[model samples]
Target: MEKQIDNHYRYLQQHFSYLIRQQALLPGEKLPSERDIGERFNLTRMTVRQGLQTLEAEGLIYRQNRRGWFVSPPAVVYNPARRQSFIEYVSSQGFEPSTDLIGVTVNPADARMAELMKVDKGARLLFLQRRRSIDGRPVLIEHIYINTALLPGIEKEDMSQSLTHLLRNKYGQAYHSMNLIFKSTALLEDAARELGAAAGLPGLHIERTNYDAAGRVLELDYEYWRHDAVTIQIDVNDA
Candidate 1:
């Protein structure tokens, strides 16, 4: 009986996978409800859900809260060596990009933050949180700690726009070097809640430290991304 059920679900999975690959179901297209799918396939709702879950795990589909499943868009390609801003890269890929400033404040640096920023403990740092969306879907949340001493009066600028642009245009500071680390992990409770994903869902975590021309730390950034939303690529060339 279990084997039969597994084959049944596999049939449904293959059916949908075909449609998606054929472009019969375009990206961001919604899938029918479990009841409808079950009725059409003569399978139980549980079986239908199992098929959909498989596709979701494979990054072919995703779910919105109470909105059912959707065919996922192509993953955004991120080349860390390129110095393009988020807006630039996202637009180059033919997707609309936007950012929402969730909060901004100046806070005294704690021990860990101070060490990361290479600043003394208790030094004031500008903290910013933002939600970044692509094609109208929220996919990444960013938390940034700015070294205020380097960019004095930065807090007075608009935080909703790209900080990279602000740094270049306003302060004449372009990114000189960066250290980055990426990890595959489960989303934390608060980050999941903000991204409308269930707590403990698979996610991608990125830690980045930006440096200035003088080799001083400019910012420390932590980013939480939906596992399906991005594909990281790096190019290697022999010097």
Candidate 2:
């Protein structure tokens, strides 16, 4: 029975995958209802859903709450090695970029944060939560911890604009370098909800520590990105 179910789901997966590849299902085009698909394929709704999920994991389709699934748009190319801000890189790729300030607060650093920032525990940090979108589709959630000691009064500035711009123009500081880590992980429930993605969906997790000319950590960034929304590309360095 298990083997039969697997075959059924694989068939369903291939059916949709082929159509999407042929462009019969264009970007932003909606797929048939799950019930409809199940009936048409003579499969259980669970099997139909399993197949659709396989396509989703492959970055071919996405679902919106109450609206059903739609063919995913082109993935935004992201270069972590590039020194470009999200707005800069995204716009350079010809996609519209926008940011929404989810919330901002000041919090005392914990032991782990202190170690990461090279600051004493209880040092105040400016925390910002932001949602970034491409072409009006929310794709990334940013949880940024700024060492306010390095860039005082930053909390007073507009939080929605690019922090890199603020750092350069007002504070006279820039991202001189960064320590970065990337992982493929399941999206946190809250982050998934914010991105309009399913809970526990696979996502790209990026942890970046931006530094100043003095090699001091300026900001620590935790980025959660929708799996289908972006692709990572790293240039080979001959040196």
Candidate 3:
């Protein structure tokens, strides 16, 4: 049984790699039916399906009901030390950058948000919610909290473009670094609405704390990435 499972996995790895290299399994392209793969491989349909399932679990593919599996697109790898806007980062990779402003307002910071943003409770903060996309498909939903005192005119700024750019260019605030924390959680209704994900589906949640050059808190951003839409890569250097 162990060897059988191993063979199935090994065969799947070869088939998946071939598809990727050949563009047969193009990024965001739905895979063929399990029956079709089985016929092509001369293997049982169950085995083909199991292989696909393994690929999906490994973050190489995603499944949608009635739509089958599709190859996942590469994620935006952000360097914490680099001072570039999200749009700039995405555009550098030859992808179109766009933002859909879900909502934006100034509100009193809650306890949780205060801790994340390093602000006092009830402090005024700019709360901006948005769905970021490359081309047209929604990839990430972000909730950003900006210190109102730092960027006094943040509310009047354009909501359609990169907030970081506006802050650097208009507010004269330069970003020094950002820390990202990751966790797994089920998608809620709000997340589903922004990410086009089904409610209760699993998702990748990331909390980002951005700081200014002077070490003042710039913004606290929470982003929810749709499952299968991204594969995160972390490069660690031994000190």
Candidate 4:
């Protein structure tokens, strides 16, 4: 029985994988329901799920909590070396991008945030949270901190638009330099829920510090992304 289950799961994986590679299943196309798949393959639902999980791990597919599995879209190429906004980069790559402002607040910075922004511990900081999507698929959740003292009245601007564009147009400010740190970890519950992803699912975390021409920290951005939704590409120019 165990051997039969092994072969069954492998068969399921290979069958779907072949169809995906042939483009018979286009990106974002939904696969058959798990019960249907199990019925077709004469396997248990649990076995079918295991096979689907295998495909998901290979980045060939993804599953929403109750939405079933879908063929994975092409991963958006992300270049930290380039100073481009989410809307700009995603559009340049022939993908639609959108941002939904989740929440915004003005609050005193904690000791850690104050040290990072180089402001007084009790200084007001603008906190902005947004969910960014590619091709109508929610792929990123942003937790951004802005040094309000540096850019007064910024909180009044429309928060859903591109921050990079707003900074340049409204304040005549652009990032002169930036610091980025990355890690692979389980998605936070809040982020996962916002993206319709399963809690504890593996995802990417990015911490970014943007600086102005005078070397003052302009913004701090924390981005959480679906692991399969993007590929980080950075071109370094040492010369």
lDDT of 3 at 78: 56
| Model 1, span 38-128: residue lDDT tens | 9999999888987997888778898898999999999999898998888999999999999999999999999988998999999999999
On TM-score, who's better, 1 or 3?
Answer: 1
lDDT of 2 by residue, 1-239 (tens): 99988888888899889999999999989999999999998998878888888898899999888899999999988887788889999999999999999999999999999999999999999999999999888999999999999998988999999998999999889799888899999999999999988888899999999999999999999999999998889989789
TM-score to true structure, per model = 0.94, 0.95, 0.74, 0.95
Which segments of candidate 4 are over 4 A away from where they belong? 1-3
Clashing residue pairs in candidate 2 are none
- Compute the lDDT of residue 100 as modeled in candidate 4: 95
Local distance difference test, per candidate? 0.93, 0.92, 0.78, 0.93
lDDT of model number 2: 0.92
Ranking by TM-score: 2, 4, 1, 3
lDDT (Cα, tens digit) per residue for candidate 3, span 1-239? 87976786678767896877687767888777887877877768777876876676556776665677778777666554556677887788777778999898899989988887778999999888999887666878998888988778778888777777787789887677778898888778988766655676677898888898878898988898876665556668798
The number of residue pairs in model 2 that clash at the backbone is 0
> How many residue pairs clash in model 3?
0
What value does the lDDT take at residue 116 in candidate 1? 88
Scored by Cα lDDT, where does model 1 land? 0.93
Whole-model lDDT, model 4 = 0.93
TM-score of 1: 0.94
Error of 3 at 74 (Å): 3.2
Candidate that beats the other on lDDT, 2 or 3, i.e. the better one: 2
